[model samples]
Target: MTQKISPNNYLITVANDRYANSTQLFRAAAMIHEVIHAYYHSVVDDNNSPTTNLSLNNFPALYQAYAQKTYPYGVTVAQHDQMATDYVVSMAMALQEYYYNNNPTPYPFLSYEVFTDLA
Candidate 1:
């Protein structure tokens, strides 16, 4: 379910599992995304009207710009989505890497292509 975090200023919605278990990178990106959203709503939509609100029409354009800004090295909408996905996977990988690094136990893994597609 979704909830309003603030009066038309912010709304909270349930995201996919990726976001829920993301590492610091995803966390950071999520925060940035929200801020950019708010910025667009408050500034672009309001026409600098001084009322704090987001404009639905401006969000997609703002999101595109945000994605480009976040991944300037390889910028694209798909790339941005992949990066966001990677940020989540990195969390799981980091934990597993740490465990395997310390333990002598062998590991079993999945097909792994699922992870590599994040390009």
Candidate 2:
């Protein structure tokens, strides 16, 4: 979940259940995805009026990589958010693979179902 707390600040929450019972790779990827979302939203204000400011157009590569090819110019606010989510998840997965090869100790672990349920 994403929420704008202030003018340029956002809060992104990732529930423990999201990665519960998943693989280490999946957990690491999800962590990266959420972190990226936090970073992206920090720079690009999603709550701003897209029609007036065209904030969505600022992320062209995100649009090209995740959105439909027909929308070459830009994407709607909803499309932009979805594209950001997809792009970050893909990037996170790739990063997780790289970390696995280089340094695997700090990778995210799968949440324990019992603990997650309690939380």
Candidate 3:
């Protein structure tokens, strides 16, 4: 969940129970994913206008650029946001997998393949 705690700050929360038994990499990835959401909310959405109407053409240039970058096929603004969020989350998960596999720490209990499959 994402919450606007102040005019200039936002907070993202994940259920504690969800990560209680997860690996450090998994937890970090989850947090990073939420942070990406928060960043999109605060910077892209401007902490307001949760839903955007691209047809109105009132969004920032960055948002329009992103829409063009990912949804050149004429998707709605909401669809663009969803795609961006999925992309960010997937990238975070991939980074987590990379760290889990490359780091010297003995995280034998952590299974990157299982985590990716589950995700």
Candidate 4:
């Protein structure tokens, strides 16, 4: 089950496996991905634009939009968010390795610079 937590400002998705049957590390990994998504959303934009709403097609536009915004230091939050997504994708890969016996990984299509890296 995947859910949105408004006050905390992130979404959490749970795999359909029994917790006891799963490796604790993978469970933690899933939580890490959720945390990354929340953090990415919170830091990149102050306004909750519909673009920030999570979807496969809208992710790239959202990332580019945030990356182009002007802030105090001239550093875009989009860069930082992309880094967070990269880290999450790496984590998700490890988790998928454990779950699927090293056969595949998650979000394998997107690059490290794009938030789609973990989408």
For candidate 1, list the clashing residue pairs, or say none.
41-54
Give the Cα error of residue 93 in candidate 3, in Å: 8.1
Ranking by TM-score: 3, 2, 4, 1
Q: What is the lDDT ranking, best to worst?
A: 3, 2, 4, 1
Which regions of candidate 1 are displaced past 4 Å?
1-8, 14-16, 48-119
27-67 in candidate 2: lDDT tens per residue?
65555555655665555544343644554555535544554
15-86: candidate 4 lDDT, tens digit per residue: 565566875554666576556657655644433446555454555456555456643332235435555646
- Top candidate by TM-score: 3
User: What TM-score against the true fold does each predicted structure earn?
Assistant: 0.32, 0.40, 0.47, 0.36
lDDT of 4: 0.51
Between 2 and 3, whose lDDT is larger?
Answer: 3
Output the better candidate (1/2) by TM-score: 2
Cα lDDT of model 1 by residue, 1-119, tens digit: 22335434666454678677775434544554454445434443444334536455455466557767886653344444554664546534544454346556575553434323321
Against the reference, the lDDT scores of all candidates come to: 0.48, 0.54, 0.62, 0.51
**Model 3 score (lDDT):** 0.62
Q: Assess candidate 1 and give its TM-score to the true structure.
A: 0.32
How far is each candidate from the true structure, as Cα RMSD in Å?
A: 10.2, 10.1, 7.7, 12.9
